[model samples]
Target: MTVTWAGANARRLARQHLHPDAAATASPFAAPGDAVAAMLGAHAQVLSAAELSVGLRGDGLTRTDVRTALWTDRTLVKTFGPRGTVHLLPAADLPLWTGALSAVPTGPNPFPGNARMTPDQVEEVVAAVGDALTGAELTIDELSDEVVARTGPWAGDLVMPGFQAMWPRWRQVLHLAGHRGALAYAPNRGRKATYTNPGCTPLPGTGALPALIGRYLYAYGPATPAHFARWLAAPKRWAAEQFAAQAASGAIEEVAFGEAGPAWVVAGDTDVPDAPLRGVRLLPYFDAFAIASAPRERLFPGAAWERALGGGQAGNFPVLLVDGVVAGVWHQRRSGRRIAVTVEPLKPLSGARLRDLEEQVERVAAIMEGTAELTVGPVTVGPHA
Candidate 1:
């Protein structure tokens, strides 16, 4: 039997706890870790956006709550995740992420010979990084000094491009070290961010990918190997092989996904809701829903395809969702105790949707700890940095 996008969307929204009724009374998540685990990980390259991404899905969670979960309770760890980008993942799941990510073959190095490290050198740096951050936090510069001290002068060569400056060659393995559970973000020191070791051992790669794939399907099911490949930036052939091997072992199964054709879901998770999700949501840039949902054309139909997406990328601009589809673009600007919210709807909203939009704005402002003024007009700001 074929599954409709409606069914897929309903399952995904419910799994992510983004369904309309998920906000009523109590939260489904016991803590920020539960929320982070629900979506695999929350994009954290833009920390504030990541906070809103997790906060909106959780009940009555403030920005401070997310911060406390990360820096205080240590329930969440900021590290390099899928596609080698910064993400906030559940601390307990570090082993899974590190193991899965380390197993994926990295793409060809973009750096020149002088800047890139050999495989052995890469291992040395990862080990040195782990050793340096074992029980203390260090800023990037401090880590560089320690890495050079431990690994020798070649490790300190200034050849890697940074913020208009050259970083040390050892910096090339920073993400790898993160994926090896040797590095994670610590609380900011004055204005500089610091790194520390999570101190968790990573599972072997062979035993981790199967579990990780099951977790992925649970959060974004009715997917394809290509979808999984795209999500992790892994090679398509590798993803297909992994999925095929899993299917042969009865870990996953395939089903028709309406017009989108054959898609895979966890073997026993084929059921879907009778009705699709319906609600008005203001999703910040790189929100998991905007990024992880597949068959992009359906999620960002018509003009939304051109406006909501940036050359097929979903997270460059914050999106306004109606009934689980991208309906508009929105931007927020804060001034003292008030926030100015500008929304540009692709189509005129009905009265009910307009009311829902206002309510959503109120929720956003509350999470932001500010009063809000909404204007449904063109958003003049450019994409976030």
Candidate 2:
């Protein structure tokens, strides 16, 4: 059956708690891990933004609460997730994530031979990293020393070009180590980040992709293999093949997605919301909501397509969501105990929507442990870190 974009996005918003009723009535995610899982994963390239990404979706969660779940409770593991980006994923889902991510087809090494490690050398470094991180967290430099000692000088050869210097060849496999269940991020030491092994066993990769596909469809369904491919940075052909196989097994079913054409949803997840989701939200940079939603034309419609996006890429700037779709861009600057939130709306908003925007600003400020001053004007700042 064909589903309208409004119907599809409504359900997607409800699943991710991006709607007003869902965000207000849904039981607050029992823990930060639960929130991370619901969003698939929270992008953590900018840790503060990641915290807000998770915090806002759940009821009354502050940045400190999110940090506690990460550092103290250990319920969330900071690791490489979809698209090989830093993300906060649920610790309980590590086995599934590791199994699934490790099976993803990666392109050939882009680095020069001097900077790339052979398959066997990559394995050796992954094993060494696992050994070094077991039961102890080590900063990057410390881990470098440990890896070199355990592997060899070849492992530490500074051949890969970095910001201003050469990087060790072994660093290329850092994310691979995470996918192999051998590494995860630990609490930072001052300004230096650390890594540790979560000590969890990874399930076999054999049947993980189909299961991951189901999870993806549940959260962002009425989607296509192309959408899945874009979300994971996996090859589109591979994604299509997987979808075909899954469909053959009756694991997923096709549906007409209005003008977007046919899409897939988990076999039993064909129900759509009765009405479009309504709400105002302030989404942080790289928020999973903005990153994973597909048929980008719809999620970022009209002016948002050009303004909120960066050369067609999503998540470069913070987003202002009205009715589960990107309506504007936002920027936050903190000064002492106050936060200045500036929103640049692409379209004119109603007086009631403006009030809703103000309330959202207050909510964002509360989550950040500060007061917010909202300004609905041109946001001068550009893409954030």
Candidate 3:
């Protein structure tokens, strides 16, 4: 239907506010410095590779889409891997996107679990990895070995050191690297690329922070600072303040989140309840539209989500979106070259919803080159007995 700029702002924060230039899509790596700058803002960082990847798709484009359409080198922008991350933005966003997205987090850490090391040991590991990756790029395998050799006793050997405390700190170190411009990605990460150490630059401080937050809300809002905080994993107080500052500007608008005060948003960026909505689709696991916004249960039931996604690692599982609403959950897997996709429903889908999910799945298949099988089925439903 006719989704108003306002309603669009409210419901589709992940999609509405993010705007990577058409030029980057035209030629993603051809001196995409400007496009990147526009996309990422001043700090030039992204919070998580997966998040960036999903945001790109929500933009109606995928990482590879930017490549095929942009017809530029993939080595530079989206595929630039590691921090164990990927960013779907152009070369320019390296600055601001990092500034906005990189500095915080939500949920538990996604880093591989390794709890043997103390903070200093973790620092040593980071140092070892950074040193190996300083001039030349190295794979996680290579980096892991170096870390083991340097620190000995191998606390996180070959493992990503996924403990909760370490995860946040590691995220910061990577963010610091991105700010330094030392954060770029390696050649490939298990076939996908890794984030590089594009070098370092000083952060923009508090002033630039809110602007960065506003940009995020512009692209993804009508939510809480808690949501923003969770998304960035920044301290709660700092995140709330950032949202407030941005809200003061007419560019932001706050709406109610149940009994709470209105959540901050880019005012006209998402659903305002007064407007209609656009078409719907099945979103990927870790899709920005699904996880990026908070009161996450806003779209789905909490208990069901925990069950569907295996607790803290809610990153797994597919998401269904009908108009602006989250419809349900689904998933895809690959056996050899065969891709099997399945939809496990939380609620029964209407005929129209089923048709919509099919279309979205095809879109996903197209992204993966349609080389594998895809399927859909009910999650768990039993008698009232």
lDDT of 2 by residue, 1-385 (tens): 8778888888877777777888454676757888899899999999999999888887789999999999998888999999999999999899999999999999867997667788899899999999999999899989999999999999999997888988888899999999988999998899899999999787877687888999999998889999999999999999999999999999999999988799999997878878657778889999987888888999999999999999999999999989889999999999998898999988898998999999999989988999999889999877873
Clashes of each: 0, 0, 77
TM-score of each: 0.97, 0.97, 0.64
Evaluated against the true structure, the overall lDDT of model 1 is: 0.90
lDDT of 1 by residue, 108-150 (tens): 7899877878889989999999999999999999999999999
lDDT tens digits, residue span 163-190, model 3: 4523322333443444345555554556
Give candidate 3's TM-score. 0.64
- Give residue 196's error in model 3 in angstroms: 4.0
Worst 10 residues of 2 by lDDT: 22-31
- The most accurate candidate by lDDT is 1
lDDT winner between candidates 1 and 3: 1
Per-candidate alpha-carbon RMSD to the true structure? 1.5, 1.3, 7.9
Candidate 3 residues lying further than 4 Å off, grouped into runs, are 1-63, 66-89, 99-135, 140-180, 189-195, 200-203, 245-258, 267-273, 276-279, 302-313, 335-338, 371-374, 379-385
Model 1: what TM-score? Answer: 0.97
Positional deviation of residue 99's Cα in model 1 after best superposition, in angstroms: 1.1
* Structure candidate 2, residue pairs in collision: none
